[model samples]
Target: MSIRHGLLALLDQGPHYGYQLRTEFEERTGATWPLNVGQVYTTLGRLERDGLVAPAGEDGEGHVFYAITDAGRAELRDWFGTPVRRDSPPRDELAIKLAMAVTVPGVDVREVVQAQRRHSMRALQDYTRLKARALAADLSAAGPDPDGPDPDGPDRDLAWLLVLDQLIFQTEAEVRWLDHCETRLARHRPAPAAPQAPATAPQASAPAAPQAPARRRGSGSARR
Candidate 1:
């Protein structure tokens, strides 16, 4: 996640202390990434060094505040304008595991797929439940105009709803992908060959006189 750009975007609005930045970030992103206070300060330092942000004095409580610079504004504009690049996606551990499971010997790829599907389904359910609660709360708070849009209102709840929806969709997608992997594995896996025992044919043989090896010459002479 681009925490740097995220901080810059937040700073674009106004100057804020580290804790404030972290709080606002979580509020907007629904704490999905959960920015740490130390991390916020660290990011602020980098942004200051990079001329994207600057120390804008301190608040009444002596908390140092940061404000976005012209450079940061330009970067934020570009970030909003540019489409997210999908050529390189974040590495998915489950996908890697399934990929190896299907290709490696002694691996039960079907079991792997089922296990991951269960985990993803559970996560999807959790997110769905969270969404339901959020929707219910939003409706309760809105009263009669529950479905009406809020033109000039705080959107923390809405932000959380969007985040939860994204997680739900992502988890659902993973479950579907696991099913796809199982189906594709079945098609790709070769059939196990039947085990064969050693073939031994019984045969009748005629008895024959066996010739013994000649004794050593020295031993025969001694005996004679």
Candidate 2:
């Protein structure tokens, strides 16, 4: 995520303090990516150094505010116009884990896929519920003109809805990918074990049988 561009976009609206920027960012994006106060100030400092923003004096409560420079407005406009490239996607930890699981010994790839699927499905459900709730609230606030457009123009609610919709779609895609991994794993077979040699038993010896003939010869001689 480009925190720089995000801050610039926020600054384009009006002068805001660090805490205010952070709050608005979370609110506008439906808190999908929460920013700490430190991160907010760090980004603001960078923006000032780059001449994208300037200190807009202190408020009555002694809170320092920052406003977007002309350069910042131009940058924001360009960002809004440009398409986010996907030729080189960021490294996904889950994808890396699944890939490693399938290749490494003693790792159950199916289980990994199933576990991720369950987690992703739950996230999808949550996003769906949030989207529904947001819509319902907006409808209620619309005061019986639920089907009509809002007269408030571009507002925080609209911004949040857009962000929530994106999250829902992204999570749905992840669940589908996990299901694909499981299907592939189902057809996989492990290597067979090696064969072993059979064992043999020892044979017994036969008894001698010629002793009776000698005894009979001796008896015949005595009789003669």
Candidate 3:
């Protein structure tokens, strides 16, 4: 998510100082993505320059509060209308590590794969636990919707639950892909060569005793 847009969204809620915006953003995201105070101020500066936000005023502490402009609200609406682009996928560091491991000598690729699978499985478990917590929070915060007879209004835990769900899905996919890779590797392995039977020894031929009989027959006849 763009920090600029995030800050604008927070400003859309209410006027907020830089520090307040940073804290609120982290609270909303459950700190899965922490924002630096410096980044918050920098993004605010850019937003002010773009005319998307403006200085509302300063507090007694000399901290300037910012509020979203009409332009910012329009941008936020447009952002909500458009789906995030997925033309290019972000690089997966684990995938790159495994790719290099298989090509490089002395690297145990299967060991690497197993290690990653273990890590991903642990992450999946963590996300699953967090999801349960989010669901419980949602139930606890449930109230009648103001606009309708629906038993549940918007849950405050929705943002964290969405982030947790994404983590859970991604980790599960990694584990399954690792298992598939192991199966493919095993299938592609070369088969062992079959052992040959011992060779048989050739039998020796009989001596040519018949050849001498021809010469002896001639001599014997002459003698006769």
Candidate 1: where are CA atoms >4 Å away?
A: 144-153, 190-224
**TM-score-based ranking:** 2, 1, 3
Clashes of 1: 0
Model 2, 1-224: lDDT tens per residue? 99899989888889999999999888888788999999999999999999999999998999999999999998889999999999999899998998788789988777777788888889999999999999988777767565677664348778889989899999989988888777777667543457777766666677766564445445546553
Query: What are the TM-scores, per candidate, against the unseen true structure?
Result: 0.77, 0.79, 0.75
lDDT of 3 by residue, 152-219 (tens): 23433777788888888878888899999888766875334788988988988978665443454455
Name the top lDDT candidate: 2
**Candidate 1 structure quality by residue, lDDT tens digits, 8-120:** 88899899999999999988887889977999899899999999998999878899988999999999999999998999999988878877876789988777778778888
Model 2 lDDT-worst window of ten: 211-220
Instruction: Record all residue pairs in model 3 with backbone atoms less than 3 Å apart, i.e. clashing.
Output: none
Candidate 2 similarity to native, TM-score: 0.79
Model 3, global lDDT: 0.83
Better of 1 and 2 by TM-score: 2
Clash pairs, candidate 1, are: none
Model 3 worst lDDT run, 10 consecutive residues: 147-156
